[model samples]
Target: MKILLATDGSSHAQAAESLLTSLPVPSDSELCLVAVVEAPTWQSDVASEHAALREELAGYRREVEERLEREVERLKSRFGRVSGVVLSGNVVEQICQLATDRQADLIVAGARGGSKIRRWLLGGTSDRLARHAPCDVLVVRPRDDSAEPARGLKRVLVAIDGSASSRGAVERLASLPLGEECEVIVFQVLAVVRSFRMDIVEQSGDLWEAERRQAHDDLNWAADRLRPVTPHVRTVLHEAEYVADEILTVAEEHRADLIVVGHQGRSRVSQFLLGSVSSAVLRHAESSVWVVRTEDADVS
Candidate 1:
C-alpha cells in the first residue's frame, strides 16, 4: 500500500501522525509526508514590504522542510519506506496530483480545526481533498489537540445504503489491518418521506416494508463480510428523514472513533453534489472520517 500523508504543522496534524502509527499499517507500505506551502501573494502597492515578505516566506519554507524531514524520520519505524516533500501550490490540488502520480491507495490528513465554534466545521482544504482526491481519504480529528492523547481507535461506524460505492467502502476498509479487538458497527439509515408525499406515502407502505427487509438482510451480509476484520461487528438500522444527521447522531451516541462513508450516496448524483450526505458528514462530524471511492474517475 502507498499513502500520501499531508501536514500543515498543526497539533491536529501531529495527532494524525500519532494515529497512523498506532494503527496496524501494512509492513511494506510506502509513506510520504507532504507539506504544502501555499505560494505567498502580495500586492504591488506594498513594494516596501516585498523584500521583508520574501525573507519571511523563505524562512517559513525552511521551517516547513525541517518539519517534513523530522516527520519522515519519525514515521520510518511504522512503514517500510518513508519520504518527505515540500511543495508550493494549492494544497488540495498538489496532494491530489501527487497521489495520482504515485498511485497511492490512501491519503491521510488532519481536519482543519480550532477551539469553540470551529470544532464542528471541517476546513475547506480537507473537505475539497476528500471530494477530489484520486484515492481514499482519511480525515483524522483528535478529540482535543491539547488535552486528548494519541491512541488507536477502538470503535468504528460505517454507514451503508445498499449502493455500489457503499459496498466498495466496505471492501476497502476490510483491507485495512484493524485488530480483532476493534469493534465495527455496520449501520444504515432508511429514508422516509413526509409533507407533500402523504398520499404517495400511504400507497408505498408495502414497498417501504420490502425495502426495509432488504436493508436488514444487507446489513447482516455486510456484518458477516466484516467478521474477518473484527469479530466484534454489529448492525444498526434507523429510519429518518435526514441521513447525514442520523449518521452523526448515531456515531456520537456510540462514541465511534472513526466514521466511514461511501464517496457517492445511493442516489449517486446527490453524493457527487456539494451538499451530499458524505460531504455533510465530512463537514460536521467530530470523529475522524474515511471516504472510499470504488471506481476511477478522470484525475486531470
Candidate 2:
C-alpha cells in the first residue's frame, strides 16, 4: 500500500506518527511524509506577488524544510520504505494534490494542533480533506486528548448504510492486509423516518422487517469482505434517532481503535440541506476515524 502522511511536527502530528508504527499496514508499504508551508493570506492578487511577503514566506519555507529533514530521518527509523517532501501552499490542498500525484492508497493525519489558522486536521481543513482527498483519510486524536486510552488496532467499527458509500469503506478496509489478531464489527442502524400518523406507522411494520432483512444482507456482504483480513468479524444492527451517536457508543463499548466510515459524497452545504450520518460520525467520534469515499473504492 502507498500511504501519504501529512505532519506539521506538532504533538498531535507526533501522535499520528506513533500510531502509524502500530497500524496494520504492511511493513514494506511505501510511506511518504509531507509537510506543507502555508503563506499568509493576501489582501489582493498583487499583494501575493509582493517582494517583501515573498521573501518572508521563502525564509519560513527554508525553516520548514530543515524541520522536515530532521523528521524524515527520525521516521525512516520506523518506516521501511519512507520518503519526504516539502511543499509550499495550502496545507489541505497540497496534501490532496500530492496524494493524487503519488496515487496514495491512504492519507493519514492528526487532528487539532499548531496555529489555529493553520491547523491541518480540524474544522474546515479536516472536513475538506475528508471530502476532497483522492483516497481514504484517517484522522487521529492525540492519546492525551482522549479521556481514555484508545484500544489497540485489534478492533474496528465500520458503519454501514446500505449504500455504495458504506460498501466502499469496507472494501478499502478489506484491501488492507490486517493481521490475524484484528477484529472487525460491521454495524448498521435501522434508520426509518418517524411518522406520527397512526396509519403510516402501522403500515410500515412490514417495511421495517424488510429493512432488518436488508441490513443483515449488507452486514453479511461486509463480513465476507472482511473475513480475509480476520475471521473475527461480528455484525450489529441497531435502531436509534441519531445514528452517529450510537456508532460511537458501540465503538466505545467494543473498545474499537478505529471507526471506519464512508463519505456520503455530499458537500457541507449539500449535507446541511440533505442528511447527515457519516459526516456526523467523522466529526464526533472520539476514536480514530477512517473515511473512504466511493471514488477511492476501486483504486487497486
Best by lDDT: 1
Off by over 4 Å in 2: 42-56, 77-80, 115-117, 146-152, 265-275, 296-300
lDDT of model 2 at position 7: 78
* Tens digits of per-residue lDDT for model 1, 160-246: 988777888788778776887799999998877665868888888798898899899979988888888887999999999888899
Clashes of 2: 0
- Which portions of model 1 miss their true places by more than 4 Å? 113-121, 145-150, 267-274, 296-300
True lDDT of residue 236, candidate 2: 92
Alpha-carbon RMSD, candidate 2: 4.4
Estimate the TM-score for candidate 1.
0.91
TM, every model = 0.91, 0.84
| Span of ten consecutive residues with least summed lDDT in model 1 | 113-122
Clash pairs, candidate 2, are none
